[model samples]
Target: MARDYASRCSLSPVRKTWLAAAAAILLAFQGIGAQKVRVEEELEAYPTESVDLRCQFIDGLGKTKLTQVSWIWEPIDGQRDNIAVYHPIYGQSFPNLSFRDRVVFLQNSLENPSIRISKLRMADAGRYTCEYATYPSGNEQGTTTLTMLAKPKNSAKVVTVQAGSKSVVVAQCEAADGKPAATIKWLGSVGGNHSTTTANGPDGTVTVRSEYRLVPTPADNGRDVVCMVEQRTQEQPWVNTVKLSVEYPPSVVIEGYDNNWYVGRSDAALLCLASANPEPTTVTWTAASGSLPDTVMVDGNKLTVRKVDDAVNTTFICEAKNKHGASKHQITTIVIEALEDPSSAGVVAGAIIGSLLALLLVVALIAVLLTRCRRQQRRGYPSSGDSIATGSGGSNGGDYGNKARLLFSGTSNNGSKNGTGANNNGPIYTYREGCDATGTLTEKANDFHHHHLHHASVGNPPSAHDILLSGDIDEPERRKFDLDDSMEEEEERYDRFGGIPGGGNMLPPAYHVRRGHGGDEEVDVYLDDDMESQRDGSVISRTAIYV
Candidate 1:
């Protein structure tokens, strides 16, 4: 009902359910009209595990009346056969012989008009239709469908028996079903030893059984004989396990691993040397060569190994008997060998490689950081002009010459000096008169007096380039002082006739150039010591104020 309410279904069951619903619903729905005959059917008094065929109809007034109900059966050949399975109105009720003792109509004739049938058979699995007609009016009637399902069977039981018993013993296998056909079997413990055990009767229904007959004996106990039962050809079969106990002392003894084994193994076998009511017994090893492992272990009913050594060449044997008889089997040996560890090497190698890769990555990162630090340090500016001042003596000259030379010789930078008194990395020059800076000095300056005393009285220094006697040439002097390449600004702007913007830009302390006319007092040139910027331009123009 829950499955149907979900409005979903499977192939076989759902088809049958809906078809039954259609038949029953049709009978019920048609009774709504006037003067109609309604049918209600049911079964009574049948054995357990049988089908109860049923149908019911209720009109507007809800009354009950006996009527001639029509019943039909459609064989697989598709022929519709009318069967008087039951008809209360005509003072007659006939059922199919196929039903025989298999069904009983429990419907009461005197007081009730309903037809009830009981006692089910698997053959009753089919569709049955009932049609009820009214008095003096066969035309008006209602019909319902009936379905009978065979009852299921009880579980199967298994039994076991042993070899060589003196007396015959009967093994009985039983299972219950409701008119359900059953098959029985007598099975042997070993493979391919099965017999189609015959049941008591032809139909094989009601009570079905199989038996194993053995004469009275002490050796018949603790042997397996199983019974299996399956209902329909398609149902999954079920089985049982039973051990038959024989009354005699044990014989034909054998012992080994409960499971199977492969080739080349060390095994201990407890063999059966004798068989009888009172079996004979003793233990020992047997083979072409009586070779056995130096190490052998034994317990009450078991043999084991603390270690399985391949050097032992695996062989063991045991002999068994009661007071009756004895037998022997080849020694069973179990083989085993050492297995090397496979994953450890690969795991270790991977770890080593990964560690190396990670360490290399860290080292590379550290190198990059150090290079950046050096670059920053190289760009660091000195706080004052004297930060790198170096002292020097005059270049073999006098007072005015001495002081100037002393000031300008050697270096003002931390590195070595060039001939021009500038830092090491540059082109140097000595003053020459009207000679292009391209010219070389006739001789290096041994005396500074030549340079400072250009307009002085008395003789000029000997290495005299006419530059010493030249006119008041401040132009060349200043031009010679080109801005350092490291300066923040280029030197080109200084050549614009010295009208360069002289002070702070954009913010306060702004330079007002006074817009000096061409006629103004001779320009007072001021060279900024803060920067040697003009590689020939203005003083350095620091792009943005640092502080």
Candidate 2:
């Protein structure tokens, strides 16, 4: 009956207001009990890592004794599902088929009721709530958000696009299996044009590919090209880099020599330098004109000249070779002036002849001087003066005229006089004006006659011209004889009889007469044997007589 009256009775406006106030007070108390369960607002974890959805009872809240712990999952676009539940008497239970073995409840203490999700997946990333039931404080609930991150797999590759074009390639960068769509970018030495594409994977992941078309030059060789992947959850971007290699032909250069080269010297060297990707396998030296000298020696890049000469004045070519190609450089060896000029045979011959002629002239002059010295020695006289006498001589009484005669008698087979004529018995008469130092001239005359006879007894005799020349004297009182008119007659007589005018082969004889110291008295007379033999010998000698 009290329940019927209370159900039929209507309260006034003030009583209704009081009843609403009472209800509000009860709701406020329940809200305070719900606030006692504490949970994190957000939670973050990687895929394959564990995530905890915690719910705890606040201390001093009068809800210390726990009865039940229930966990639920709310997806982004799906219905709420029960994940796990626990009661002290019943242990733990998984209510959702999808999260059955992946969810667990923590029961370290009655005050804390938290659920952990192991090996979290993209599907597990959602809002989770935990509800706690206490005996005296009723039930309290908390919610937490779970975030799962999956890193993208990044790769980079450089592939050759064509043959004979190693310098050109395609640089490709890819990012796969990313939870969210990944952004791919090409950096670091990528040049020219490039393109990007994105794909969705079956496992709710994204894949991004970036292909950069590159035409690399020689300068870009060995450089790095990078591909980077950017994702929302990653702090550092994913990077992939590739290095480039380039090949080319050889570059040839010659060094170690200059224009200051010369012949007959060892002052120059030639060096061959080749710059190539692959080092040159061979180096050679050659001449453009003449053949290479035997003195040239090659040691790697160095070409040494053992001796330089005219043969080296040609174009020298240095050839270098490698796998790529061959290259050559040519240089002309310089030649300088020689130290000695060349002379012709004619000039040399002329010099020799002139030297010989001068030598002959010198020899001839020496011979002439020697002959003069010998003649002076044989004459027993000084070369340039007459001999002085210690005494003076006066004229003698005997006839001593300047007439010389030569008589020759024809000989029979018996080597004796063949005729008994008056000329044969008497001495041939010869007159001279000169007188001996003795008062008589008979001894001087006898001496000259005996010399002539003795020479005639030998084979040779003086001609009539020589007899007449010997008779002439240089004294002021003597007569001068003219030979031009009478030379023919004397020559005729010499040819007819082979002798002088006396008819005997004898040369003109000479005499020397010395005077006595007291007066013009006879001292001595001597015949010269050289005058009897040599037709050119001096014919007169005199000595002074003291007064």
Identify the leading candidate in terms of lDDT: 2
- Models 1 onward score TM values of 0.25, 0.42
Off by over 4 Å in 1: 1-67, 73-90, 93-112, 118-125, 133-241, 244-547
lDDT of 2 by residue, 253-338 (tens): 88877775666667578998886656788888888865677878888888888877777777788888877688888877777765
Report lDDT per candidate: 0.41, 0.60
Count of clashes, each model = 62, 21
- Give the range of the ten consecutive residues with the poorest summed lDDT in model 1: 398-407
- 188, model 1: CA deviation in Å? 16
What would the per-residue lDDT of candidate 1 be over residues 13-110, giving only the tens digit for each residue? 87899999999888776645563444434322223355444444434554545455555654334666654544443545455566445444556442
Angstrom error of the Cα, residue 312, model 2: value is 3.9
User: Scored by Cα lDDT, where does model 1 land?
Assistant: 0.41
